[model samples]
Target: MGKLLENHSKNLLREAGVLVPKHVVARSPEEAAEKAAELGFPVVLKALVPVGKRGKAGAVKFAQNAQEAFELTRELLAMTVRHFPVEKVLIEEKIAIAQEWYLAITIDKKAQTPLIIASLKGGVDVEELSQSAPEQIMTKSIDPILGFAEFQAKELWSELGLTGKPLTLATQALTCLVKIFLAKDATLLEINPLVLTENGDVAAAASVMSVDDSAMYRHPELAAMVQLGSERTWRPLTDLEKRMVEVNELDPYRGTARYTEMDGGEIGFLCGGGGGSLLSFDALVSFGGRPANYSEVGGNPPERKVLGITKGILAKPGVKGLFVAHNITNNTQVDVLAQGVVQALKEMGKDPKIFPVVVREAGVNDEAAREIFTKTGVEYYGDNATITEAAQRMVERIKALEISGEGI
Candidate 1:
């Protein structure tokens, strides 16, 4: 799942014939004021970060005039919302509201079906809506094979007690939204306050969307909007994370290397084999070791790809030790993994012994990998040491290094 920023999702909605407020993205306060002036008075200024609950964080503000837009834009740009430094703000033409409603189309993962959730109770968070008045909210499941139909959309809004022009417009808007959701392979497409303007027109006042990354290959148009692997971080990708993305993309067909930074840790985690990495992380945490980052490198990556990821793993601040382990390989070559790790350590001028580097990889070419690791003065283990045992050894090595304060 990859979340699309508000501006991006709104633009997609507009393109699909769903009404949305006229908006522009401003990178600075001056730009915001200019855009506000161009869009007319009474504007909304929102911090353009990837996380939700911006209103709760005071990241969403209203500006009655150009001067207010300038001040609010400055305030928003200066704040960090949910760890993401605000670099841009969304300026929109504020609508005069008659009523606020809610509509969202998403995949029902549990039932493997498409789900539509709508509520007449709007201007409130969906969670709050569900909690406060569950009856006011309507939940409908669409058959994957049959799909959502025009009549189905109309019936949903009508059943919710919407009638006259609002009912017809809501039906059309939701139908379009559902089309957009399915067309884009979106995991979620939600309009928080599907507003009924004073003019009796429905507008998607807000949109929060996430698309399936596995289906991204089909959406070349969305490439620039979505940063792959964004689900791992609710906010923007850090510089290190970006580089790891590049390394992973370097040979898209061969292997995968995913990196995510964590707060306040010392051990540099380097592991792979998907499920194996999770277990490795658990083992490390179980042994009271704090890993600075989580990384998975696997699928028979070449030495350079492996080396690139290794360099990134060790580059995080406070990474005083390194722990590398993986499941017994099916196809990934241990010799290649060893070569890459050794090459990275050598290039980074790291002495494995004092720096606390540990590896517990096994399978095809294990003999070669073991020889290379030993020759490089790096602690080595094959299937002989369970992944858990390897993590224990890594913890002890880091402790020993802390006590000695000398390179091996």
Candidate 2:
């Protein structure tokens, strides 16, 4: 779930012996015009935002002279799209593309393998093409342990019907792309507009994307790049996220949490792991319940960490209900989690009668946790309860209190 900026993605491709267009980053219109003049006419001026679809958003423009370059840069500098402000512009020499194609390497979560996706049509939405005409796209999964073999890459090139130098270049590009994907531990590596130049030379006209936050540990350089981008954007990080990042630096082997704050709603979810959290969130949405935030107290988390996480979740405004759901696992202690929840409630000076809470604890020490909840007069569910059932019960309880006009 990590995303790399476009500049960094292009740098990775350049390091793999791919011929990318000569480019320069300009912080102002004057610098942009200078760079465009140095690179010659017909340069592309792109707004340097981390997100994609810049062309569709009018964030990318072409300049045939210095005046157009300056004007475009000035217009883009103050523009913001998708909540991201453009601070810099990339100026590059435009290539004469005779033909275009697409290539990408990414992990398939369902298949648990590396997937290679390519298409004959490029510079457009591949998803749209697939939906309208899937015959133009080619896809294959590769075993990470074996890496991508040369023969497999050759077969893919043949399937695309590319011949001669274009075929050779495409095969080489695929091989190098796979190497970069594996070497960087990237979740996604995409190259759109894998262009064939009018002179029959192959080059990458535009690199679309890449993301490799997991591999930041093994690549200090990549980690530095990530830090730089994060700093530039001035994104606000929650206390839990900052602490988790610090802990990850100290001990890379421990389980991690990906916490992001969202608009507050009625129910607060404390679910287990990624998949279970997503399931509960989707179920709550389907049952007409809005979640306050997405929080996953990972497996075997320390008691103090659990306490801190609970406190953080409860501190948000407009949280009327709480759902503590965990799947069947052997390591985590349910009693410890219960203690954290109880402590957080006490600190907030809130009464269970006013604030409704639902608990669905299963697995290790689940019985003890249920007993604790009972002693405190809190509602609790056992191991066999379905996720939908738990969500429905919470919604019903909240609705009842709403009907009564309770102050929660």
Candidate 3:
């Protein structure tokens, strides 16, 4: 998933002919004040972060004048909502809302189709509203092959008690929004408090959007706006994590390499595939091992990719040991994986003897893998040793090092 900040999402919505409040992005308190003065008074100030629920986090505020805007922007800039530091403020002219509505488009994974959700009530939590007053909300599923039509959008709003001009304008807005959602290959496009102005005009007051990262190749223009690989993390990517992204992207199509640094740990973890990585992590933790990072190396990756990710895993501060494991594989070459792991250890001067490296790789070319690992004094295990047993061995080695006063 690639989540776009509010400013970027609003820009896309505006370009699609949707009515949105005039907005400007300000990097500093002074800039915010200046923009607020220029755009006229009574503006909304929101921290420009990819995560949601900014209002609940106190990252959203209102200002009636330049002085208020400056002070409020300063406060917003000092906030870290959901672990993401606020670096920019989105300042927009506050619309006079007569009514607040909600609208959202997303994929229903179980059904494997596009889903549209709308409600006459807005400016409140949609989940809470659904539980309290389910009758007010409407949901429609669109066929991927057939697509959504303007008539469908009209019927949706009309059922929610919209009539006359508001009904027509709301229909048009929904139609445009659906088009943008499908064209951009978005996973989610949400408009909370889709407002009806005091003057009886329909407009989108706020938006949150995320596009599918796998479909990114078709949308080069969005490359700069979307924060790729953000879905896997709650906080902003650490410097080491960013380096790993570059490594994985080096050979995007050949295989998959993923790395995520943990808060603090002593063991550097390198596992294969998603399911295997999770099971290995759980097994290690269950055996009193603290892994410094979570990583997956699989899909017959080249030695270079493996080497790059392994180096990153070990480079994290406080990583004193390494643990490598994989399930029985039919495609991934264990010999090639061994070459990368051994090379990375040599490059980092991490001796398996004192540093505690354990390997439990099996299948394709396991015989060659075993020879390579054992040559480096690594505790190598083939299919005979289960992942759980390998994890227990790794923890035991770390314990032995601690007892001997020869810790890495």
Candidate 4:
């Protein structure tokens, strides 16, 4: 889940040969006014932010003249939509739309396939349309492997009551859009208010797009437009979060190391595996322990990757104790993990004597894992203790440390 801003989304559509309104980027109200004057009055001024519902948030406005454009641009620039402050404005020539339609391509997570949600009605909430008039909207599931064809697109529009030249034009637009969706490995590509101009030409008036972050490796061209790992936050990444991203990307390949900072907590959580991380977090919370940060470290990571993540977890303010856990690994070696954790603790000058550190890992090379951890003077457990029991032990250790004010 990686969302592209409106300007980026429009750029993608234009690159794919889709018709879009003539637009210009403006960093200030004066620039927006100048662009409005150059493009002629009656323009749309939209805030350049990644989050959605800009219209409802007063980030999207219309200006009928240069003066109005200048004033509205100032207003848009002042908005903070979904915690994202406006830094730029997109000024575009307003299209005289005769009709509006909706088209979107996304995944049906439950069905595990690409799906299309299209409707004859547009410029309105898709959810409202679904509830108000379900007959006017159609949901189509796409065969991701075989792909969507031009004929399939044509038939789709034709069924929605489009005919003649409009039908053909809409079909071509849909075909091109589908190609962009699949080729880019996008999670979402939606054209709301896909307008039919008064002159009877089809154009995409607005678009919202998000690509799969896991597939970003295959799309170097998108690097400049996308802020990698932006899917997790509505606002800009905090300094600590940015550092964590650097740590993970520095490795590129070897294993996974992901970290997300929490608001506030006392325990630093370093868990492994996708499922294991979630279970660890839930178990900690269930045992009345607050984790300062959430981390996922797995896939048989090398010492460097493990140490990088472990240090990050413990660096968060107020994190006095560390809780590390992972499920029974299939391929991940517990010894390698133990080495990384111990090295990070030593580098950070953390001693189990003062700082409570609990590790529960049992997998390949468990014997070595136990030995390394115990030698480091860190509390360690193997398969004998369930993950839940390990979580309890970590909580108890932290509580005793807090009572004694040793690490506080």
Candidate 5:
């Protein structure tokens, strides 16, 4: 998923009719100091990195004068927190906070539903507060189809014990936040410390984070803000990622592939559909095997797309073993996936015998897929094999090959 920085997040909020502070982005310390002077004293300077815990990492600072602003700007610009180098800073007018709270709308992948999390306690770690005082956090799940109605937001405000204009302001903010979350196709939209001023006005004072990688196509402006440095390096995408992103945008009804690279042992996975992936991951971990990547080729993906996905897994480095496992209830063909795997290996100039591939396809077309794998010289397993069994088999195969000093 794509992570938006403070500036990009603020733009989305402002577009949704949420009241955010007047702010300017400065590339240099001099520019930041000048912007702070223009905005007046007691300004907040935040490093423009697409990561959370900036405040805890000392990436966020306050300046009461132009001199302090300049100093803070220089320090932040040169600082590297969590491996993300700060190149720009946001200078915003400091709002006088009367109260603080949390508000967020996100899709619960397990529940397959939209969820809203809120708290009366603001301007602090919600997790920390929840651990120390569990009663403060309020959470609700919303139907994706029905969404958050106005009454639902109002009821949330009432439950928080907010009164008068502040309640109205909060209700309005909640409604707008929901709209923004839906409109942007966001996976997560969080506003930590949604502040209420003494003047009875609501403002998003701090910690505005959003993850909306899916909506990048519709919002070119937001896509442009995705930083091209270490932020991308962590889960480095290959040429396939760029292609799949384009394919995702073109196909309205196609399944999505969430591909992220990881370092470790062999045995690349193509699992998931109704928590099977999670189970497989845990089983792999239990077997002392580190996955090469977390790649999910979702339900009913076309044979060609499956081929592309297999190619992606093969392209990954240190992936000397392959595990293609899916649940029995899933309606994907075994032959389609096996064909993809064989084609990818051939195109990459790798032999299945040398690479040690394992296929465990169940559900529809399982027999045909098993036959295909057998003919292609790839190891095949049946639906009766447990997750741990499949993982152990793949890991053992890799270990066998490694000990034999085989070249692939």
Candidate 6:
């Protein structure tokens, strides 16, 4: 899933014949003021980040005039919402709301079909609505093969106490939304506070959308809007994380290498397999060791791919030691992994003896791996040491260096 910025999601809704507020992107406070002026008085300004809950974070503000817009935009720009910086602001015309509603379409993976969830009680968290007034919410599952019908949408809104023109317009908007969801391969399409204006017109005041990355080849126009690999992280990608993404893309077909940097730690972490990586990380933490980054490299990756990820792990600011561990493998060549680690350490001018590099790899050509690692002065373990034991050794090695006053 690649989450689109709010400006992009609203544009999608607008193109689908669903009414959306006129909006523009402004990168600076001055630009925001200009955009607010163009959109007319009482404009809304929202941070252009991919995360949610902007209003709670003070990333959403209102401006009665251009001066207010400039100051508010400056405040939003200086703040970081949910770890994502507000590099740009979305300026839109404020709508006169008579009532608020919610509509969201997403897949129910267990049922393997599309699920529609809507509520008349909007402008509040859906979880709160579910807890406070369960009956106010309505849910319907649509058949993937047959598709959702307009009559079904109409019936849904009509049952929720909508009888007049607002009901009819909402039905049409929902029908269009479902069509857009299927056509665009969207994983989630949500319009919170889907407003019924004072003029008795239905419009999407805000939207949140994400599309399937696997199906991205079909939608070239969304390439600029969607941030790849964003679903894996909660916030914006760090510079090192972006570099790792590029490294993985360099050899897309051969193997996999994924990396994520932690907030602050001293030991570098590298492991093979998802389950093994989690296990290793837990083991490290349980033994009073802090890992600087998390990485998974497997599927018999070539040496260069392994090399790239290893170098990235070691390049973090506070990383003082290296820990490499993997589960017993059938296809992955331990010797090849050993070579990559050795080359990375050499190129980075790191001495394994003083750097506290520990390895616990076992399987396929273990003898060659042991020789390679031992020759380079790395503490290597084959089947003799458990993953837990390897982690403890890594922690002890770092402690020893610190006590000896030879810390790197």
Q: Of the candidates numbered 4 and 5, which has the greater TM-score value?
A: 4
> Using lDDT as the measure, which candidate wins?
3
Candidate 2 overall Cα lDDT vs. reference? 0.77
Tell me the number of clashing residue pairs for each predicted model.
0, 0, 0, 0, 2, 0
Q: Which lDDT tens digits does candidate 2 get at residues 1-408? A: 455667777888889988788888999999999889999999998888766678899998999999999999999999986677788898888999999998878889899898999987888888898999899999999887888887799899899898888888888888888888888777777888788889887777777555555457787777645522222233435555565445334334444433455665778778885677778888888888878877777657656666666776777777788888876756778888788788877788656666888888788888889888777767888777977788888888878878988756
Candidates in order, TM-scores: namely: 0.86, 0.84, 0.93, 0.94, 0.85, 0.85
Question: Which has the better lDDT: candidate 2, or candidate 3?
Answer: 3
Report lDDT per candidate. 0.88, 0.77, 0.91, 0.86, 0.77, 0.89
lDDT of 4 by residue, 216-260 (tens): 778889877875554554567778877877777655666778888
> In model 6, where do residues sit more than 4 Å from their true spots?
106-115, 140-168, 179-187, 211-220, 227-233, 298-300, 329-336, 362-375
Provide the global lDDT of candidate 3 against the true structure.
0.91
| Pairs with backbone N, CA or C atoms under 3 Å apart (clashes), candidate 3 | none
TM-score, structure 2 vs. true: 0.84
Ten contiguous residues with the weakest lDDT in model 1? 227-236
Better of 1 and 5 by TM-score: 1
The pairs that clash in candidate 2 are none
lDDT of 5: 0.77
Pick by TM-score: 1 or 3, better one:
3
Mind giving the per-residue lDDT tens digits that candidate 1 earns over 348-376?
87887667788999888999999999898
Number of the candidate with higher lDDT, 2 or 6: 6
In candidate 6, how many clashes are counted?
Answer: 0
Task: Report clash pairs, candidate 1.
Answer: none
Count backbone clashes in candidate 5.
2
Stretches of candidate 4 off by over 4 Å are 229-233, 251-253
lDDT of 6 at 59: 84
lDDT of 6 by residue, 50-147 (tens): 87778887789899999999999999899888888789999999999999999999999899888999988878888888998999999999888999
